[model samples]
Target: MDLPRITARRSEGGWELEIAGLGPAYVKRLSDVSEHGRTLMQAAGVTGSEHGVQVKVDLGDELNERVRSATQATVDAHRAQLEAAAEMRRTTMSLRGHGMTGRDIAFILGISPQRVSQLLSSHQL
Candidate 1:
């Protein structure tokens, strides 16, 4: 049977993690955690927090390399999403500039007219 892969990302205080096929979680660095929480995180490799558990993964060189690769992939995916959204907005503005109505843009873009209006209002374009 196949299981979901866990992705790790570097965040402000620590790491954000997402389990494939499941929801996401965040884990702060040991230094950022409270003294009591840090102790638990060290001893058990994790400690519970408001959102989820903060984790410490002490890994061998090979595992560290794998984690780094996964993290990069996650970051790259997020960047791609931002780029795509920007492209979509550009295309929408171009179509509007050509005198296409919101309903026309929505039908052409396969989105609801309300969503078209929202996009226009959001970007103020």
Candidate 2:
């Protein structure tokens, strides 16, 4: 099976991503992508817009679901990163609310105390 090839170019507006041989139908499928898929595409170097990032995929034969899933995995990975970050923030705040010192929280989280202070300061808690 041919893995999807990703390339990028700088445009006057922003970065544009090109997926070689991903025809119009596949492009449409990507266009109607889930939020996670969109996040993955952004991480893959496509710039975001109010509507969505504009992807430049080359025309080719029809693509299968397997290929689409392979591409969608990129988006899912990005989504997971976002979820993890949110959870970390919540956990840090919860620990702080429990009267844990910044140093203690840092020790528990295996992060630096300074980093813990920064996280607590930036957040309302």
Candidate 3:
């Protein structure tokens, strides 16, 4: 049985695997892996059962490094967004506690008064 040509590349948050020459049975097995929270592998085509399960792991160290870097960048960006949101909430609350109206808070924070009202109402602040 000839082995399938397998190639893998780093994707945004995971790996993109490509498998060629996979039979229906083998393709089902790959889908099972994904459903079970194991490594994700997708079959691109089917030729014949004589090919067995031609497997390939093409992602090397360099690709792994890039994936890791991209993941870290995404995490950092999300963290910054969360921190900014928290800061905005804190500033808004502080201003409100110091006798500021919704209009005043909105002007100080450079947001619409309606948004300020919504935030304050939702947060019960």
Segments in model 3 whose C-alpha atoms lie over 4 Å from true places: 1-58
User: Candidate 2 versus the native: TM-score?
Assistant: 0.46
Residue-level lDDT of model 2, residues 1-125, one tens digit each, is: 33233434344444344543332112234333334344555555544422454343333335445567778998899999989877777888999999999889999999999988777876765
Clashes of 2: 0
Model 1 stretches astray by more than 4 angstroms: 1-56
Name the weakest run of 10 consecutive residues (lDDT summed) in model 3: 33-42
The residue-by-residue lDDT of candidate 1 on 1-125, one tens digit each, is 22223345566767655443334456675443344443433454432332344344445578889999999999999999999888778788888999999999999999899888877886794
- How accurate locally is residue 32 in candidate 3, as Cα lDDT from 0 to 100? 36
lDDT of each: 0.64, 0.59, 0.61
State candidate 3's TM-score: 0.53
Query: Number of clashes in every candidate structure?
Result: 0, 0, 0
Better of 1 and 3 by lDDT: 1
RMSD of each: 13.6, 14.0, 10.2
Higher-TM-score candidate among 2 and 3? 3
Against the hidden true structure, what lDDT does model 2 obtain? 0.59
For residue 83, model 1's alpha carbon misses the true position, in angstroms, by: 1.1
Task: List candidate 2 segments past 4 Å from native.
Answer: 1-67
